[model samples]
Target: MSAPLRVLIVDDERLARERLKDLLAEAGDMQLVGECRNGNEAIAAIDAERPDLVLLDVQMPGPDGFGVLRALPPESPPAVIFVTAHRDFAVQAFEANALDYLLKPFDRERFRQSLARARDRRKALASPLDTELLARLEALTRRPPHEPERYVTRLVARVGWRMRFLQVEDIDYLTAEGNYVSVQVGKQSHLTRETLSALEAKLDPKQFLRAHRSFIVRLDRIEEVEPLPPGEYVFVLRDGTRLTSGRSYRAQVQRALELPT
Candidate 1:
């Protein structure tokens, strides 16, 4: 008697998406509106499709599930079921006011329960952007407070449906491209749907320096720092990639490279 709930599935893993698709099909009361492999696509789908519910994956390259939720400006985003492979994110997922958090490899019964909960909560108009939930999510994504001061060791990036895990040491530099950040590693570069400011917060300041508004360079990778005329400077990476430092960031750049100002 009730109208079928429109649903969207967002996950980087093909098998995970396929499994959710099959399960949703088996659930008689829901209709699949669209499928997105990454957070960017998911955000676009949410804007375009405006589905009644979103099955969001907790971890992915770029925006991830939490980032997607934070991006939505509405007080009440469509119902969401946080699907993730990591059990450690459960508390934070709920704290972010999710409809439910579905752990990876969930059985049909568990999946159905999650779906049912979402269905029941569909009418709630409260926004998922609660301050408490957001704070928890921010903490969850960073290194634990108790651990010794450390920087992120790995970066996850998604291209189409493929996910790439880049080691921090392998990264040559980072450049801002509009709303995305280009993660350059060796000859390969992956565009991630994340703001430079947000990504900078996660990086270790000791190893990476924001040489310019649009650029973040790895300290040990600098092969040379050429002092250009007119008080400008250019950082040459070990691979010969040249990144110009911004005029306003000159002092920080000098200090970072230990160049006498």
Candidate 2:
């Protein structure tokens, strides 16, 4: 019969990787070629193993799922089934493109269906990098210079296996934590995998202020600003959270607050 379909699993989470491995074992006529923990590893494995199909996670420590796909060779790239915890606009894009994706915490029946689709796609030798799909994905990731910038009204926060959309207006502050940002909304704080500067770019300048190298605070949330020595100041928020300004941000903070320089 036909040769066993070679597959690679790429995900940062150990549990996720294990789950995929278990499911792949049940998927007859498929051989698990390798497993990669991050995007960089996934790229290396994809290049080395040349697997027929890949199960790639959307978010990880290094380049995300889209980044990995972008790095692949244009001609005859491996078929992909995205594994994502997000139910955002990207999901709609995937659907529009007729691409297969496994939403987080998916059941066995869904997994089987997605795998069957991948098998059919492989048999048909369908090129995964369709021009329209790539264009749509690029559009989702970036905006054309001619297009007016549209700031995000909501941010997706992953809680366990579920995703929740947090209104940007409800965010009181954001702080950098390695590769992730801690979004503070009143007493609740949700962690999302986004750089502080990247998130800053999406925020309205009039509503948010970069108070420190690691902190961005909502302008309206500042209840008090206590002056400190040598151009430093401690800001108290409506939620009673206090954040000290970084030395380099002092001037900007002053201008934002219209305080005497």
Candidate 1 whole-model C-alpha lDDT, 0 to 1: 0.76
Tell me which residue pairs clash in candidate 1. Answer: 75-127
TM-score on alpha carbons, each prediction: 0.48, 0.47
Taken over the whole model, the C-alpha lDDT of each candidate is 0.76, 0.76
Residue pairs in collision within model 2: none
Which residue runs of candidate 2 sit more than 4 Å off their true CA positions? 92-98, 126-261
Per-residue lDDT of candidate 2, residues 39-123 (tens digit) = 9999999999998889988889799887787576533457688888876635332421224778898999999998887676554
| CA RMSD (A), model 1 | 14.2
Error of 2 at 67 (Å): 0.6
- Worst ten-residue run, lDDT, model 2? 89-98
